[model samples]
Target chain A: MKSLEQYTRFIEEKIAGINLEEEPRKLYDPLRYFLSLGGKRMRPILTLISGELFQISNEESLSAALTIELFHNFSLIHDDIMDEAPVRRGKPTVHIKWNSSVAILSGDVLFVEGYQQLAKYTDKRLPILLKRFNETAIEVCQGQQLDMDFESRDDVTEEAYIEMIRLKTSVLLGCALEFGAILGNQSEETRNHLYHFGVSLGIAFQIQDDILDLYGDPELFGKQVGGDILSNKKTLLFLKAKAISEASKDARFGDLLQMAPTDSKIASAKKLFEEIDAKNASLETMNGYYSEAINSLDQLESKGLELGSLRELANFLITRKL
Target chain B: MKSLEQYTRFIEEKIAGINLEEEPRKLYDPLRYFLSLGGKRMRPILTLISGELFQISNEESLSAALTIELFHNFSLIHDDIMDEAPVRRGKPTVHIKWNSSVAILSGDVLFVEGYQQLAKYTDKRLPILLKRFNETAIEVCQGQQLDMDFESRDDVTEEAYIEMIRLKTSVLLGCALEFGAILGNQSEETRNHLYHFGVSLGIAFQIQDDILDLYGDPELFGKQVGGDILSNKKTLLFLKAKAISEASKDARFGDLLQMAPTDSKIASAKKLFEEIDAKNASLETMNGYYSEAINSLDQLESKGLELGSLRELANFLITRKL
Candidate 1:
């Protein structure tokens, strides 16, 4: 089986080959442009990795991989528009590059294209795959909605915040793995195990992202650290800090919230988070999910499906630097 | 076979029965509110009608019918947001009712819900049905893009406008019909005929809508007469008038465009459209599509499937009061 890196390169070539109708340049140009600003392509690669674990060839699983990637981009386009975000991956977002209308319609076309790609799978599992895909699509939208809703409300609980992140970020990763397993013709029970493996990894990865926003190595992380705190985003780290402050009556944490977003604010918030043990608490939770991910892999290994690649990938996610 | 009225009532009931996630009220509420502002359930009815012609029972075809309805509403919500349309069917548009983000995400969830409804089809035809749905969905986006593109350009030709409407408005009607036909186990040749029947009917219906905005019974139509003209919309009728004016260098028509949109301008524009035979020209085009629609129905009839209901529906669309 090809390594995860090889699968990612293969997926890159496949994405480069995607053809969209050229006439409505306004409708399709944004899609082409957005896809051109490539990210890690982690989600699609996961589909391939799961397929490898299930002994499905990359060719047989490529459609689902592409579908996941296309759907991911579609969500980003619409989500960016919703957030009124200006840039994605250091470039103008689709909405900013063209207009919101173009973003909405192009994102929509990309969504339909994802479904079209999935329809290429002419297997007995197509219906089940379609069913799971539709469910995950709706869940992702709900996740985005919950995330947005959390931003405006002060009543967002720690549990609710985790659920939002799960819906928003993690479910699609789980879905990618599940689709791969389904296409490999694995039993539903086996697919569920692999799916949980993905879900746990995604949750851990997201927590790491939250932690890194305040604690990442400046030279290595590439982005401005503490950007989340500066933006007042209700990330898991912030929620954890709030939970600890409320339990301990920590007035210093409340004062940190009142500070204007500045370099000093970032440094002070970082120090406060560490002192209240909020950072430590978040790290514990992240490790919990990380351990849960490994436990899922162990379950898969017990079933005699070799998971060396998936195991390495999980480890990379946990130990990832940037 | 159920009468069109009975089928409409059935669809109305099904629409009312739709359930969405309750926790994220922000996401699902807009969907519920938009669907509540009911219009003629024309598209879904076509799905059931096509099913009946192919001897697929209404009960069996309800899922496809509901799928079409949900998809139609999904497109409407997103299109309204794109157009910044303030109202739909005399109620606030989803964007206006909630906000653009809510509308975008809610519309997305509704689109996913449409696919879930479609997945209820357990037959071998599900894959083909999904393929057509995705194709039509993409075409609709392209059509909307072209329509928006036409809004800012002076170079939009009459031919391009028709193709835009065909993509934006006609293809889904065709798809709704085609989906039903496929579910009924019809041959590809037979389904194409039924699909073309819907397409031709949709095109003719849209042209009639253009004519009605200028000349419909104000009391019956329930909208201000010549609203399209006053709004400076480059509808088919205006495009036809422009084409005529360009050919003849009719200075009066050119002056009419520069005139402020008022009661006097509407009257003069209506008179000019008649005097220059633009209205007559559009009527001929409409009739051409109407005849094409009938010819498709005739082909379906030649296959020994009864076309009474579909034929009546087409005639109703062509000669309806409003």
Candidate 2:
């Protein structure tokens, strides 16, 4: 099996080969620019890794990986516009660099381009793959809608939040892995196992992200620490703190949240989080998901497949600072 | 072959059967609302008519027609947002009624729904249909980009304008017809002929729309009669007027265009259009495309197919004031 580094390298090379310099320069330039401003490339890498684990040919799986990456970028471009975001991955967003209209149209073309890549697959599994992709794509949009709806409401439940993150974020990871497994001709059971594994890991990864947003080293996180707190974002930590504070009849947490996002206010919010043991609770939830992910992987191990690389990758993902 | 009214009724029935009331009401409601606000339903009707002309099964062609119509509405929702359009078909646009974010995400879902509808086609023609759809979808975006780009520039050539409109407006009509033709198992030659026929008809239809934007009755048009003129949109008429005035070395047309778009200024622009013979030039060009469209139909007729309904539809399209 290829190492994770080999899969990452393969994805990078494939992305580099994608030419986005077509006509209507305005439409494609933003696409090229957004793709150039790279992310972790984690989703595509997951696809390649799953393909390798399933003994798929590299050429057979490359297009699926490319499709996953392109879809990810397309979602980001549109999401950035909706979020009114100015920067992404330490660079200006497409909507900021160009304009919203350009971003909207370019993002749309990117979506079609992703499907165009997917249309290259002509296997018997194509229908299932396309169906899963469409369902996942729609769920992602629903998740975003739910996320926006949550922003305006103060009573977002933890269950609802987890479901939202699963739909918004985790399902894509699951879909990517399942896509690779399908291409590799894996059995339905193995595909389902990998999908569950990816979803559990994705949920854990996002919770870890929330924890890192407030507690990780500033330089390592590569973003403004406490950004969620500043924006009054109802992240997992905030929800947990609210729940704990209400149970304990403590008003300090609520008071801290209501304050303007000054340094002192952020400091107070952090202190309140510590006082409420929100970090430990969050870690507990994260570890539960991590264990669930391993349990899914263990089901695959019972089928006699080596999972050493996947285990290491999962550890790396859960333990990463950024 | 079905008459135009029969085709229209079939399309309306198919649209009514489409279920858009699935979960996440915020996400899907706007889609339902947008689709409910009716337009000409011209593209999908063309799909059905093309299918009928080729003697394809109605069940086989209905999904493709629904996909075309859904895709059209999807583009309109997003385009309305980009154009900052407040209304469409005499109703508030999705973005205006709800918000841009809702409109953007719903539009994204609508596009996915179109593909989901396409995924129902399990035939040898599936890949080709998907490929053509993707290519057409990308071109539509490029066309919209070019249109927006033209808005900020003064040097757009007539050739560039024609290409832009072809990308923006004509290709989808061609694609709708070609999609139906492919599903009908038509010969490649016949499919290409139908596609070009639709393209030529589409171009002439758009040119007629531009003409009506200025000269048609407001009640019949169901929109502000002088909207394009008021917005200083460089429609075919505006471009033709510029070309004609430059050829005659007349400055009145340029002067009129530069004036504020008051009622008197619109009157003066209309008079200038008459003086420069821009109306006659536009009509002549429209007739040329109408002829080209008929010629393509003639090629289809050579395949021993009757062309009465198509001829009637073409005449109705070019002759309609709105």
Candidate 3:
């Protein structure tokens, strides 16, 4: 099995090969800068691993892998503007370094580039790939809208939150896996199962992200802990906390939650969170999703001859600390 | 030839027929709303005329026509935010009605829809159409950047301004015509000539826009008269005036020109502009382009058939006061 560092290096090498078109230099320079200031590159690497699992490691799969990653970064650029996020991956966001307008246009050009890259596939898979990518793109936009909408509402259900996360975050990962399967010439059933594997893994990953936002070690985590709490973000942990702890019994907890979870409120919210054990509850829910993801992987094994690479990917994704 | 109002109604009726994908309601609602606040829909009608001239009114041509219009509106939504313009076509701008973020996302979704709409063509035409569309899209972005960049610089040449407008406003029209020719399966030479025809016409149309901004009847214009002057926008008039009226010979004109064309400076700028007959010079320059546009139309007669509908469309475009 390839180590995470090995996967990271592989993605870096792959990303370096992408050739951005000229003339929209302003629009694409930010893409270059942003990708250079790398994150995990997990999505593309997972795509590569998924392809490898199907015993397919060719230029086409590598290009598909890069296409998804480009698409992912394009979303990040636009999402950062929507979120008003100042930093990403321990660096200034594209919008912050430039202005929001440039970021918006740059992100737009990147989105176009993403599709342009995907269109490089041979005619047989191109239509299917494009149709799926377009559907996923639209869903991601809808998920983002729901997430923004949730910020204003107090009565968001855990189920609704999970569904929103599924659309916003999970579907793209599913797309990455499905795209890999297409490149591998896998059967439709295998592709669908792999998609489920990706979706479940994504949900687990996002839930873990929510947990780490409150409970992670600052030394280990790249971002400020409890950032979501401070922002009053509707995450799985918060939803579970509100759900499991009866409102009447947690009236004080609600009152404290109204304040930004800063130095003073952080302690109180932590105490209340502990009282509800929302962190552990979120972890348990995450584990359930992770278990389901593993099960999907197991199901795919029935059809697959080679399963080692995909299993390693699932394990690495499910077990990541940050 | 169709009257302006006849063409306008045709555009409105045709645009109204566009449908969004079901579900993911929030993402596409703004597109519907933006389209509902109707403009003249001139671009698509121009495309339709291009197709109709060749007697090519198939599903692919109609979809291509619709796609161009959608792409135009998509750009307008983003451009409105960039311009910080509050109103469009006598209604609130999308960014003003919703937020910048929503406007951004909706515009993005519409962009994708434009491509999806284009994909309805046969595979033979699809690649060429998409490639042209992509080039035009990138050119549009570059043009916008040049427009924005013009705001900060005092040294913008008239040639540079013309090129910027060509990139910003003309390329898509050219692509629209060229796309129709491709759909009609016209020869490459014919298609290229038609493209140039549309581009020359686009430049004339834009220059006429500048002329109307200053001199058209206010009620007919549906916008602030002398707006370019008020903003000290580097329009054709300003560029021409700056080029001809030497700073030494016309000290007041030079002084007013150096200042930002804000409301406070607008009266003085107008006085200085009148001193140099800048408006008249701009109109004369506009006429030159308009004449050149007509000449290009005359040149298109040799392409294949007479292209009577395309000629009519060009005449209508150049003759419009608003």
Candidate 4:
């Protein structure tokens, strides 16, 4: 199996090969700029790694990987607009660099381009791949809607939040892995296992993101710490902290949660989070998902396929400090 | 061959059968509201009528027809947001009724739902159909971008305007017909001819729309006369009048064109348009396209298919007041 580094390198090269210099410079330029801003490229790498596990050729998997990456960027463009975000990856977002209308239209073009890439597949697997892709795409939109809906309501439950994240974030991961498995001609059972594995890992990844936002080293984390707190984001950490503070009748914790982001308020919030074991509780929940992911891999091992890279990658994702 | 009314009825029934009521009511509700507003449903009718031309069953073509309709509505939702217009089909647009964010996300889900409909076809035709759909979808976005671009510039030529309309409006018409032709198992020669036929007819239809916007009966037009004039929209008539007035140095025509739409300004602009024969020029251009479209149908007639309904439909579209 290829290393994660190799898969990432392969995916990057394929992404670079995508011709974004089409006419209507206004539309295509923003798309090119957005893609060039570069996230971790994690979703496409997962697709490649999963495809390699199923013995699918890197060449055959490139289009599917590109599809996932393009779709991810498309979501980012639209989500950034909806969020009224000005920056992404330390750079001006497409909507900021161009305008909202340009961002929206370019994002739409990017989506259609993703399907154009998917249409390159000629095997019998194409129909199922397209179907799963459509479902995943719809789920991602629904997830965004729920996330937006949650922002206006104060009574959001943990269960509702998890379901929102699953729909918004995790399903794309599952869909990526499933695309690879399908291309590799893996059994349906194995495909389901990989999908579940991706879902669990994705949940863990998101929770880790939540944890890191408030706790990670500033230099290593690549953004301002306590951003979620500043924005009053309803992440798992904040939700748990709120729940614990309310249950204990801790007025201090409640004050800290509602306080504006001064250094003291942020520090006090962190102290309270530690006091109530919110950090560890979040970590424990994350670890549970990690375990579930590993169990899924173990189930897939019965099929007699090597899963060394998958295991290694999952470990890296769950444990990464950055 | 089916009558246009039969095709329209069939498409309406199929559309009514589609269930959009599901979870995420915020997202789906706006879509339901938009679809219920009811445009002419012209594109899908063309698909069904073209399908009948090739002896394809209405049932077999239903999914494709639905795909075209859904895509059209999806484009409308997003375009309304981009245009920031308050009304569609004489009712509140999705963005106006709900919000831009809801409109944007719902439009996205609507696009994916269109693909979901496309994925229902599991035959050799699926790849080709998807390829055409993707291409047509991309072209639509590009066309919209050009339309938006034209809004900011005053030097847009008649040819450029024609190309813009082709991308924005004509290609979908072409795609709808080609989809029907493909499903009908027609020859490539026939498919190409039908696509061109749709394109030419689409251009004629748009020009006719421009004419009706200025001259049609108010009750039948269902819109305020001189709206394009009021908005300074650079339609074929406007561009042609500007060109004629500029070339002849007819300052009255130039003055009328630049004047804001009051009753006097609209009346004067109409008088200037008649003086410069802009109305006749536009109708002549429309007839040129109509002839090109009929010529395309003539090429298809070598295959011994009856095209009377297609001809009648084209005539009806060109002659319709609304």
Candidate 5:
């Protein structure tokens, strides 16, 4: 019955204790630096919360929680390299601070270390856990592939963008919960309910992220406002905005989006998105997914599992999201 | 009871049956291309051979073999990007054919698929197999890191270079064999002996490679001879000559290796290595490891296992090395 802050502290201490600060400093130093630069640490906390929902103590789930956190950092380090990102969590990225070679090798080590953490669990469930992890890992790669592919093409639809987010980002959330449920000895069907709950919430959260990129509270947000617009990523809002522009024959909309990178471009793009109701449409879609997430949780409640803190966390993901 | 050629054919067919030729063509096409540009396929074949030494069928060991091959390709894809290598197996590398982003994502997929193949084995050995694979995977990264580190350091000793290659190139061979032995139900001690056998042979084979880069027949070699020289790699021959010139106080030898990249630079480097007896020194060192490899095989023989063709494979590794 620990508070969310307690779970966050446990995961952070576990991460800080991981001694990757060894020789071949070129290989491990960047990983140490990247892991030290923390974010919300939401995925590992999800693993802890999922375990608590199953009445498994967070102590029992620490190893798997570490697995999720390590894997998350692995994906981000490699993704930042592929995305050519300069900053992460208000700091230089692994590739930016060291080099891509260091980033690739360190990411590879982090990935292997993730499995090492999982292998620390000697249960018969180990093979099944590894299988699920392998599947989710491949899907994440495929999602990144599709995201890069979308960069050059303009015909990306809203459905495609949602699917991309599910693969790229959401499924890992699903898998993170699923790992805890699996470790907790929940049956496949019951564990899958927890998984779907994560998936729906993950999708909604991503949409909220797209909206926040334009209209979020700057003081609360870690990254630059309107950063996604600057990157030209085909997020859900961008897809919706493109459809609305086409419907209205707004000739100047395309020109506004393609303007030279500047403060004015972001302001103009945000103005057009609000005017065309793309922002509202994205929010509505986000709510729909959020509702679906709650429905999956209700399925769990029907089976007589208490989900008090878990539901609050989901609410916090949407209602009080920074 | 199959011949080495049949083992070779079995591995080729197993690799060919892998269908990564599906969607996200940009992500998969480069993988398909890199795999299709075949090398000696030596590591996977060793898995089959090791399995046979323990009277285990190749079919039982095929999954582990593919794991090794897929992982090998994964390392190469990422390493080639780090090395900025344009060519692989006489074809354009994945990073060259595609871009670094595609290369990074696709390599990540290949790494995960390696675990997928390993997971196909549903036995108690699965966890132990995964544990070994993860350890070997991390060491490979560390090895690559050390190799890159050596590129910048001028005072790298021979022992450090040997340890670096052992980590970078040799341990995977040892791991490939150990995986087969594990699947074959060999005792941990016996499997470890087999692992050492592969380790020694791998080290010797690498030193042989350094020698062949300067002295081997051109038609027999797949890569350009003296390619390492042109790249200014600090190979064993270079280290030996550096030591020799320091002892003899030959001032001209330092300038010979430092000359600009040209055909004649490679020729001068080769001639200087010969003059200093560095090539012979490397071969003697190669023989010591070759002997160490044979002694390990003899240890297996003392346990009453037949060592007929396996011994031949070891001898072939030394006698007929390209």
Candidate 6:
């Protein structure tokens, strides 16, 4: 049973030693540069913890965790190029640091490395593991396509958003947990429960992120709070804000939002938000998903898997402000 | 056995059915457009012919061939972005038609779908097939990196250029053949031989392309001849020219070369190339690799594999002026 810090530290340590930096620098230097700019790395930790829930960690399970992390980072690098993102984890993104073409090619190499890492597990489970991984990879891409589509649409509903996020974000988490469970020789029934736990938690995490985008304290959030609201991005908060407000009340709100959320607009939008109770509405939705996440964990507990450490991890995640 | 034209026609027919015009049109449309702006379909045809050699053909093989072609086109789209090239086959590139970011993301989705199509293979050979495919994918990225690096170096040798082309260009062809052979359930030894056949042929094919770039008749080639020469690109021709030229006579050659490969430089370079017998040098190198390719086919024939059709395919490839 690893503590949250312990799992986080393990990921950092493991990835550090997976040195991809030497000569052939052309092929691997960008990989090293990009992976070093870390995220929460929750996917890989879910893998490690899920494997630990079943039994002692082995080379097979560890490699699977590393493989998923590599794949996850690979997606991020490419996604940054697509999104024209300048920063990742408060650091210059790979594309920003080098160039988009280099980032594109490096991400391709990272994906190939992920597959190579998975191929190291040439055992009885190889076919199943590879097949599942390949399918999940496709799903991730579908999710990304949906996200891109959502960008251009004004009609994105909450349901579409949830499904989009699930495809783009949740499936990988679920796959990470399920892959680890499979490598640990968990029963199919147990793997299914683990997957549910990961997916439910992923949805909750995204919802929380949406709420935070408007309501988060900038000191703690590490990003521009209310940026999404400024863009009129159809996050949960904006969707709920649009939903909860009446047509008669739209006049004052329309005036404030029409300015676009700059310094002046920020104060104005916050005033309208308070008047309409958008933060509270967003929080209520976030709590709903958070409770659903907890309910899934409870369901997992009923299946007789060790729940103490997992519950703690879940608590740490759901309770976090960032 | 399916002739190369039959396989090419099969790919053309398959690709013809794909609807490139759809909503959220940015992602899939480029793939459709690129596929429609056709090339020789050489790699996919190789995949199919290898499959035919192993007695594997059907709708599944057709889908697999389409996958290879789609994947190849996907790479070309991204490569055009990387190279900032405006045209492909004298038509505008996807990035040129749309934008760079769209081209990047669209190519990614295409790569993802390529795997999805390959996953349609119900054969037990998928795991090994995908493993080899992933390796080749990485080599392609590495090859691109080497190509980029070669641009910065003044001393790029003939060996380095050939190796880069082999990895970036030839390996994919080899992977295509190997993928088809694996799906056909051919013997491992036979699959290895076919892979070598593809690799050798790829090398010969690329060398032929270098020759065509400088010397092919413009009408047949469908583009300006000597475009590579104009760019001062470190092609096999340039390397050979550098190698065969007298040191004192060609001493100022290095400084005169420019990035854009202008009309003035092109004429001068061509003059110097013939002066030092670089055309002969390049042709000799091309012939050497072509012989190696034919030797690889001979080895396959020696193993009692029916190679008559393959030899015809090779002849057709070698005889192409464009």
lDDT for residue A21 in candidate 6, whole number 0-100: 40
* Poorly placed runs, candidate 2 (over 4 Å): A1-3
lDDT, candidates in the order shown: 0.89, 0.87, 0.79, 0.88, 0.87, 0.77
Expressed as tens digits, the lDDT of each residue in A1-322 for candidate 6 is: 6567777778888888885647458567888887887777788888888777778473447778887899889889888887889988888888888888789888877877787777776665666676677778766776777888788887888788888888788888888988877887777877777787778778878888877676678887778877876777778766666666644456665565578558777666667776788777767766776677677778778877777877887787777674
Pairs in steric clash, model 1: none
Per-residue lDDT of B102-163 in model 5, one digit per residue for the tens?
89999999998899999998778888898999999998899999999999899999999999
TM-score for each predicted model, relative to the true structure: 0.98, 0.96, 0.90, 0.97, 0.96, 0.91
Superposition error at B76 for model 2 (Å)? 0.8
How closely does chain A match the true chain A in each prediction, as TM-score? 0.98, 0.97, 0.93, 0.97, 0.95, 0.92
Q: Kindly provide the TM-score obtained by chain B of candidate 1 when compared with the true chain B.
A: 0.98
Better of 1 and 2 by TM-score: 1
Kindly give the stretch of ten consecutive residues in candidate 6 chain B with the minimal lDDT sum.
Answer: B252-261
User: Which residue pairs does candidate 6 place in steric collision?
Assistant: B230-B261
Q: Which lDDT tens digits does candidate 3 get at residues A47-113?
A: 7777777666745577777778888888888889989999888889998998888888888777777
Model 6 TM-score is 0.91
- Order of quality (lDDT): 1, 4, 5, 2, 3, 6
True contacts kept of each: 0.84, 0.78, 0.26, 0.76, 0.85, 0.44
Estimate, for each residue in B1-322, the C-alpha lDDT of model 6 and write its tens digit.
Answer: 6665676787888889864436457777777788788778887777777777777764657767777777788788888988888989878999999988678777876776676666665446666767787778778878888888888898888888899999989988888888777887878887887888788888888888887887788799767888787767788888887766545556746654643567777667767777778788888887787788788778778877787777888888889763
Runs in model 3 lying further than 4 Å from the true structure: A1-7, A13-29, A53-58, A185-187, A247-252, A255-260, A263-277, B1-11, B21-26, B53-55, B255-300
Error of 2 at A224 (Å): 2.9
**Steric clash pairs (candidate 5):** none
Q: How would you encode candidate 1's per-residue C-alpha lDDT over A67-113 as one tens digit per residue?
A: 99999999999999999999999999998999888899899999999
Model 6 lDDT, residue B72, Cα: 83
